[model samples]
Target: MARIPTAELSRYLLSGQINRQGCLRLRRTPFLPRRPPCHNIRPLSTTTPPTSPAVVVVPLRKQLKDQAKALKSSGSSPRKKKKNSDNQTVPGWELTVGIEIHAQLNTSRKLFSPALVPESSLEEKPNTHVSPFDLAIPGSQPLFQPDTLIPAVRAALALNCEIEPVSYFDRKHYFHWDQPAGYQITQFYHPFARHGKIVLYSRDGIAAEDGDRIEVGIQQVQMEQDTAKTLAQPGGVNWLDFNRVGVPLIEIITRPEIHHPATAAALVRKVQMLLGAVDACTSGLEAGGLRADVNVSVRRPGEDKKLGQRTEIKNLSSFKAVEDAIIAERDRQIAVLEAGGTVAGETRGWSLGGTETRRLRGKEGEVDYRYMPDPDLGAVVIGKDLVEFLGRSMGVLPDEEVEGLMGRYGLTAKDAMALMLLDEGGRVEYFYEVLGELEGRLGGEGKGEGSYALLAANWCLHELGKLTEGEDAEPRTGLVTEFVAAGDLAAILYHLHRRKITAKTAKALLWGVFNCEVAPGGVTDAIERGGLWFQELSEEEYAMLADKVVEGEEGVLAEFLRFKQGKSKGYPQGKLMFLVGKMMKMGPEQNLDPASVKRVLGERIEGVYLPQLEGEEK
Candidate 1:
């Protein structure tokens, strides 16, 4: 628990500034940490910034050069190369990261108005969804909407946040074109929830041991209204789409527990999945439904007394950007400190194209935005009824889902996380649907450790995943629904499990079924129509195939003989096994048990080559 200096804290707490040439304003900052200074001094600018405070904006060219140098130093090339172990930080320093994520709740109407909220305001004409309140009409008064509270509480529960019994709203003053009211409504003084934790796993897919696991603490979860977007039209025109104005948002704040770039990225990803699971928000980062602001600081390896000055990177669009920004910034700061220059406490912006960040503004020089409790909206009281309803209706959390899948289906941690990490919920739904159908077909469940469950898991993640990947990854639609029904997929896997069809035939059947027209007699019928039926070879047939392979390749026989004499460089038994595999696959439609084929091949090889060895010894 390092203490941040109060003078430095002032820079982060207050954000208001006036330009010498003109009046410039920005968005509202909801809350700031309050830590008293060890020694008090006269304040510089508590309410407004003084004129011409020398704001040092990093030059674009310098930033670009830094990005290039960083990339080259990190060994990035035009062609993708295997990630080097050097990417991890050196042992002398530690990285600290905290995240603030804003997710728009999935609601039809605005947070405080009857205005309909569209997924994208760009899709509709300008201002079509705007209500009087959205436009800041003089007579319209604010109305508190309660529907947004349920989802917020649900999200808090999913994240293990402690819900506040009473929550209230406040107005943060900032003048912006998108904020027609000259202020934003948010829960700052009294947020909806606080003090939660998110668990993190290591790369090995095993939950880290209790002492080793990284558990990021949730500082607070607050409800707020989204501002409108200032859109640029064709032909030098710009307009405001108020459709997004006043839309509900849940701001999740995390404690500075993340120490690695990869872990920070994983934290964001896990939160997104959890949000989607609880139906709080869609977690579509590209579509603007969710975004994160990262706070990063660095300190000496063993120093726990003071955290270095942190810079905030705002509005990262994707998890990749989050990871990249943290790494780049961390390296940049360390380089600056090593060169005897100080790291600036300021806001920065990340360019997705360049994979770097640029200075937005100096934190110390910014002006403060005044905040006060809103007069119109009363405090919201969460009763037992609503809490009970939320507790019951809130579905499986992301972590719980992973554990359940692993326990019930006997899946590996990696496999479980693969399905859980899918951005599209349909993929997860389809996986379980197929899993359930397969389980039922396999005669109820004892433990999913059986061959059928393992095969189904592979097909679901690899083959079915491939089919559902790309722009059309939506579940239960198009190819997912049209071609492969759950029952059909389950039947195919079931037949493969029962050894009624070889793995090769089953794969062929799956692809053929996907590309084929509607089958008149279902998947089994389609398998028959496509001539994918497995043809099992008898014992005699197996022996004949093995004999043909052994007799046809004199070189292979020579290698086997050399191995028997202990003269071969490598194991001849391995070569023999390889030959057996090739011999089995020679006939495409032939389905012989691999064990049976191996046994027959061993007999043929021994009968033919052992006598030669015996003769040579004599």
Candidate 2:
């Protein structure tokens, strides 16, 4: 349970204070109790909380024991697993994975070239957005886009990366049709930021060491230019679309900290969410705005000292694909090793259906890139003022937004996370707007018995989730034409909450509005136009319907008589309900209250039907 001090350690790492042996000298902090100086801290950052006092030196033994006890009491510590009845240990394989995410920066032009990288929806023809510089024509010079730093620095800060004061570009040379320049201008030697970490949790926000959480280390965040798309045409022709050429991108590289494929997938999703939260990238997987290159390796337990040869699965499109590709590659590697075969280092592409990966090419060494300084661009300096300005522009991220939603609207953590994750573009904003309107109508400030935040959240996530079933992680543009407005949704909830209509009626109204079967209108007006208002039968009407149901079902009546005489074996209540439902369905215009129906069915069955059955039995 020994924990490394991540905050202080990262500060040292960024400040170049760590020794050659990777040891940190802790400086004592004032106003905190002093502890004995100690060693034996691993590089892992999971053992200690980031909010721990900023004091440096502490005894490793005491810290470990204390943290262990704390974690044990909280049920968040690693525990020994008992063997199953088969007398075998849990399936164990030390799976190591690192992921590199390429996010397309939201900018008007390319990173180093002024050429436009057209948006995905633009109608521009192929190669229209390219400039001579992007085409690498002779005498064309490169210039850096200063606007790219806003998103890059924002992403760095959001990911807990330390922004470097000075960063420069280098040429990474490789031969490919997509890169007309024969080299990509990238931050190979000194990236914009380094030494960042992202703590990922389970779908429900579980902590690390709980087996469902992970702490992934970010190696660096670098700015680079993207290549154009190469397409294959019929008859052995090749086509290049330069619309995407020289587009700005940020490559986020992580250390090999992932231990499972699912965890890796979750880490990728968490990164995507963070990027989208900061407006650093659109992260549209289907639109090709973001992608992950997962590096996977495996070794047996207790062989931590030996690093296995790894394979890089390049450009898995979606989060699910990331998971599947890693798992497939890991299994493939483990199989090869178990069969007394050597795993080769190579680059592979995800298969057509994402079931497996195909070999792309042998992995190249660093020398192959032929790295050199880019003479066209000078050192990019990020001053303190620029850093502060970019930092302020980073709005609330998912973590903070989750807490804020929970605290403000009295929602559970799961509920909050659901809302944030399924936000489908502006759907989250629409949800909050509806919640506000509902609060106003309820005559409460989200307090007391009338607070409908929970109800609203359930309706939105469940009902709206069904509507936008397969929306990508990125927000979708524009509202679906059939969907109801926030004000209308609020009105629907108000009537349902106030007992003005049954839950069934409210659902019907919502479905109608959502499908455009009923035009947009006030909740009451829509209800009336659709004839969906809850209907309460009069005493006489209820009696008549109950009598008619019994009279119409002669076979069911006989069964009821036998059951009353203790001759038949089934419950009469179910039979009565079936009859009632049949009658209710006969009139679609009438929105009957189910509770009232149940009441009438029970009364008729007990008072009128029971006596008649007893008389018949006699």
Candidate 3:
């Protein structure tokens, strides 16, 4: 007989026959009560149940081809329809959501073992900062630095979590090309901090509203080690960055209670604030060291339909990406189910280039996260005193900063909030200092809130806002703060509040600060030293003559009569103050005050508003 080829023979072996009568006909599938058969294929084991938790393995070549052929014959098999997550469909399907946020702890050294460098000084290079522990060589051991725990704990407390008196670590085994260390040291099941929370606000700045005030619950925040990153190149070979290996990571989780994508976005933003509040990490999204892996599922409204298998969107890395991925995934699933198909459980990646999410298949129930206590590192025992200390010292909370602007100063809620929120680091504090000085110097008993400081807030926040973003952004974050400090702000405010300089001229003065030969001076100097003066000088002088006027057409003394009425003719109180500002520039130092111009103006006006001498109160 002709020699049977391996491919042909293999087919015969499965079919139990070899024939070529045009096309060999194979027997139809046989069914047995003992086997839970599916898709025209018999189970590999005789007594397997359809709902059993055991892995489903079909006979390699035969099962795959048969399923494909059957599907093709029917055009396509019907897929299971997906329900809404909140179970808030038209029937009000509720969408139950929980999230897992993986933020790399900001540390001078890596986790598991010291490896990562101060990302500040060095450019990110593959394996450049790798230590022996990162390499996973034989005889390699692990270590944990105490400093890493502080920042991580601080951030958790800022998230409003209560630190557990005792929380520990475990090793989770999962094999990946990049993780040649065989297993990863992780904290699973139980984390260091539990029941933490994240808060979100309304777009309108209203704390309470329909789509605002989202609060997501915390499952637990765990500390773990990060795996090295792989950068895939065009070729099959991948470039590796081991420098990040063993980096300490904090895993923050949430309850599956959030119903909307907007809520997910809000939760991430809250975490950013929490990080900043603790001063543990920069609240920047574009940079690494912060990443959130979002867990999502869908269900139809009112169905109580079991949560659709959750699909994890991995490495979202940014708040914007988190929002975008949730939306994209929601829409993608809706489209599939609307077309009558089921969504398989899997992991996904957010494509920065495409702004989309792509699926990653799940082959097993779990990676078996083969968890065991970390051998190299010991348990962390948190003390009550240390927790208290960190909480007090934890950095600024955005909301509290806003409140400070309102209560401590005379700013309107809007302006004060804008100032602090616009610039957090050192800038808001500096503004508050200058505003305080202005208040002390002005000597107004500061009655009636929401009028003056609010105005200052508007000016300060507006200027700082212009500096940070938009196409017309500033090159310096502190540049405005510095200018505000040198008392130039004082001079400008003096003029503005005194009504001496028009509001329009006040802005012009600031613009001048941005690009003049002055290299950015304070508000006061900008007015004093600048050759550009917004007011007309002689007109001011002409008004001053009222103090000198003979009260009878002492036209020659008309100038003095005008002066008797304080500064000039037809000038607003603000204009007179600008004249005084001029005086200060022209007069000796320490003999000057902006408000004094006001007092002097009011007194002279009273002196000149005198009896006509022709005898008339008229």
Candidate 4:
């Protein structure tokens, strides 16, 4: 018989516990590798084996203390403190964050079964959208759905991922009430797409012209089946909602590259935009259409190569929660490490109003889940032609759209981002449609594109956005688009640009049309019906009105004259505007332009009032 080497025995002894009599015995754990049969080997130690089968367990806090002492005694020095983006500093720690986003694919059918994917709304009934295959009944076979592939591919391409020609699925075995099949079908060994990047700007532009941006590396985007939702009822009874079971989901994993809390939130927001742009997912965090799992860790400043223990915060439903959870976890880890303790790797849950993350369970390793390729479902073979077709149909991604808005329309980065970030492409489309109409009507003959583009962006983001801002219960954007046609808005802007209507009159017209208070006719009809057109006044008329107003308001005229002569402590321009407002109120039906009124008032002050005052003083 072969004998076990002393070195091997020593290595095995290191992993086990030493009894009172000095007998070394190994404890079997799911994560550890299997050892050789004990009957085949002779005992090397003189001490007898422990009589009891129970293994000695050490407290986790004590283990952490011992590890911290060991590291301290090893002569390792702490690194210098660093400042984060918010200018906050932890004395000797650095934060690292990574996000796992699971977005429900926007397909009619589930991922594996032929059952319909539920709407997942509050009014949806439970267990109505399930199939025999989803429940894992006997004689039911798992079949892959081809409808989910296109959206997944489009999303991967939008994130700049490289799609694999052939990818296989694996079964991650676990026992949970929500998992009806006792295992989740996922792409474990080989995902469909990998190696992508999402660039988050510090401000609004894709290029990050201010030299501040984060390039988060995408590890992989894999398709998987979502588990059912388990709702806890009274008296410890749990209700299962199988409506969401077997729903198609694409899990996007990112490399641990994020550091700041805001950056983490920005990455989530950017991912939502990308997925929504491709129409691959609903990307609505509130409706459970999208969920995020955040992995956060903290290390010393110079330990970039060596990461510390990370904890996973699961199912953060909102961007604010994502940022706050990261910050809270980071501070918790720093506190543990600074107190001469070690941080544990575990899964945590965050409440909406809670300040700290609560422990859910210990983190599971790959070995614990016992991952293996699915024998029933064969490999997914994607053709190059299909990939190319999906890529062609991707239309335009969010970053590309932002660049187009900036370059083509000469919009500021802030304005462009405002339009794009409102609600995917709706506001941007409205802006573009209005701008296109304006360009067609007023592109030539000394009409500047920049001015019209700015006008359109302002109206879309400010005016139209205000109408649909808080109306989240309804499809407010669709309602506004249906009611206010793009051509009508463009015509209103064109008339305003041509100096034929006052700015106030244009705004009132927009509000009236949006509220259905005005007729649904064109801008010309609305203006003509309301008699809101600009009433041009000749120089003689303006000068006579200016003289009449100046003569009527003696006190204001005295203040204006004194200010012009540097003898008063009041704003002469404001007094002039007050008089111009009085003049405007005199002709209520004229719809006089404020700019023209201000311009003529300034001319009267400069050419008439000041000269007259100088003559009187002389």
Local accuracy by lDDT, each model = 0.73, 0.73, 0.61, 0.77
Task: Report the Cα lDDT for residue 392, model 3.
Answer: 82
Backbone clash count, each prediction separately: 3, 1, 62, 0
Mind giving the per-residue lDDT tens digits that candidate 3 earns over 1-618? Answer: 445455564344222245654445334556623433222221122233466453343433445468657766888744533332332232333445578877767677887666655474224544567666776754568877788878888988877787898877887888775675788777786577988776655631322322546666788888887776664433343445566678777888888877666567667766765675566764344456577778777777665457776788877755556666776687677666668998778888876523357877662343466677887777888888988898887766777776676676655655654454343335566666656765765676444444556656666667645644458655663446664342555556656776556566666666565545344345555566754344433434534533432234334234444555576655355544544555556543233334554455455544554334324423
Report the error of model 2 at residue 114, Å: 2.1
TM-score per candidate, chains pooled: 0.78, 0.72, 0.65, 0.77
Number of the top-ranking candidate, with lDDT as the measure:
4
Give the winner by TM-score: 1
lDDT of 2 by residue, 210-325 (tens): 35555778999999999877555344444456677789999999998777666777777778778878888864554477888999888877765776899999988776577667
The C-alpha local distance difference test score for the whole of candidate 2 amounts to 0.73
- Evaluated at residue 498, the lDDT of candidate 1 is 69
Ranking by TM-score: 1, 4, 2, 3
RMSD of each: 12.0, 19.8, 16.8, 15.2
Ten consecutive residues with minimal summed lDDT in candidate 4?
39-48
